[model samples]
Target: MAQNLDDNYKIAYDNKAGFGKSPALVLIDFADAYFDPGCVLYAGVDDALASALRIREVAHDKGIPVILTEVTYQPGGRNGGRFFEKAKPLSCFVKGQKTAGFAEGLVPRDDEIIVSKQYPSAFFGTSLASTLTAMGIDNVVLTGLTTSGCVRASCVDSMSHGFITTVVRDACGDRHPAPHEANLFDMNAKYADVVSEAEIIAFFRSLKGEAHG
Candidate 1:
């Protein structure tokens, strides 16, 4: 899978470039605890799950901190309406599961940070902002599902928070391709550096080499 290898390379490069430098890698996952099955967002559930896992692997290899943001199932919460209507079946499956309903391929190492959130924006009502600031992070590279939703929300706020945000375009996807493309264009124009995986990887590799030399 040359494509997979290239994707991994870009992720690793981003990690290296941001490593011990100005930017920090913030990996967000739309784990099972975060979504309802019947929700329209769940249409590409498998792809979302796969992408999270792939990025997690890349981040771990580079020693970048990965934050797994878990969303609590609140019936009346921001996504509650969607949960009850479109995502009800998915929600039921997750609720019935015995273990913590994380997406597949989510095995963060001991050093990674895991955050449990309740909203679309990862920094909302969370310590993400402070954490990033404390770590001297000025740029944020984001990857995750439903590009039109959580990914977009986080990108917008990351920029507002004064972080040069980059959304790894190939690393993210949506249930439908149209919305995914539209939102990415909008975010790139107004909020983030929506670059391809290869470009990000090149940038990261250069940064990492600079640090060591």
Candidate 2:
């Protein structure tokens, strides 16, 4: 389903040109307070953490900035009780665990930026847009858990913010495959370039070669 669709897109994009080199990689994850037990958004926790680690490695090697955004839990904030109640039950399952408290991959590097967000869209009520602007980041590679929720929200807003958003299909998963597959399709049709890990890696390699050539 989702993988199949993503594979199709990847095959097409692999034949295209000008994906550009040294594009910034932004990995958004649900590793924060709002996802804690009793607060809601606990499902897909494990997948998020694992995906974060894998993306972190790739981004680090490529010298790409990896911005990790988490949903904060404040009484009346965006991700407070009101929002959770609405979004939580929609999830396939809840598996609350304190995996990545601060950042997705833990112990953030001095150069990396960690954003604390209260809403699904990292661009909302955060300096993410400005940060990306300052860094001259014209493209964003998004990955994380719960493809139907935060990931979708961020991808939409990322597109709105004028960054060419791309969701790494394999690097993102959901508690259930149905919602994930459906949402990824909708997103690809409307906003963002939905691609696979192998495709993205190959694009990065091509970029590096061109930069040094």
Candidate 3:
């Protein structure tokens, strides 16, 4: 009999980081560029956004910190560096463009923190690591657009930064199912635990229960 893929990788990549004492929700680059139909970067991930919003509501009620990320480039993409030059669609994120704005229904509350960057990983060249450290956040629940890109980048960096990272499967989307599923499998194997949005919500509720217990 042939060995299944999951069984093949199970022995080596089945390790789970689980949840840490403190978890923060990080929504990466849920920008209008990915939501706007006319935009070159659009991925048509509306269901993903809806799921993330539901997760956000539960996280907010549980007093967990919510962090949002956005990408912006200067005129002519000067500050975007090699990444901007390489990814032409990134022009949608140039400063002051409507496509650079957060998609509708993702309004950040006064208490929520927004981290803007010109790169893929939310942690790269940003104060995100320091901010998480300062807040004593030990785990991260990640969601957003483009599972194969920013989400994967952020997942690896989140683990590298010493946080227990969890990627919400239903709350992330990609240009196609191929990369989306592939990246999720890879992240689950090596970087983070890929779980469902319901699992995350239940975890948050469990925290609430612990607090009130």
Candidate lDDT (C-alpha), each? 0.64, 0.67, 0.92
Estimate, for each residue in 1-213, the C-alpha lDDT of model 1 and write its tens digit: 968865774565433222225556565655553355644335455654555456555555555556666555544344445544564433432333422255656666677677766556788878998998877677788877668877898888888998888888876767788898888867866677777666655555555432211
Please list all clashing residue pairs in model 1, or write none if there are none: 13-204, 37-90, 37-91, 38-86, 38-87, 39-86, 39-87
- Would you estimate the TM-scores of all the predictions? 0.71, 0.73, 0.96
Better of 1 and 2 by lDDT: 2
lDDT of 3 by residue, 21-118 (tens): 78999999999998889998889999999999999998888888999999999989999999998999999999999999999999989989999998
User: Clashes in each model (backbone N, CA, C under 3 Å)?
Assistant: 7, 0, 0
Model 2's alpha-carbon lDDT is: 0.67
Error of 1 at 73 (Å): 3.0
Off by over 4 Å in 3: 1-3, 209-213
Against the true structure, whose lDDT is highest? Answer: 3
lDDT of 2 at 203: 63
Worst 10 residues of 1 by lDDT: 91-100
Candidate 2 lDDT over 59-124, as tens digits, reads: 677677778765556433334545667665323222233533543345667877888765677788
User: Is 1 or 3 the stronger prediction by TM-score?
Assistant: 3
The alpha-carbon lDDT assigned to residue 190 of candidate 3 equals 94
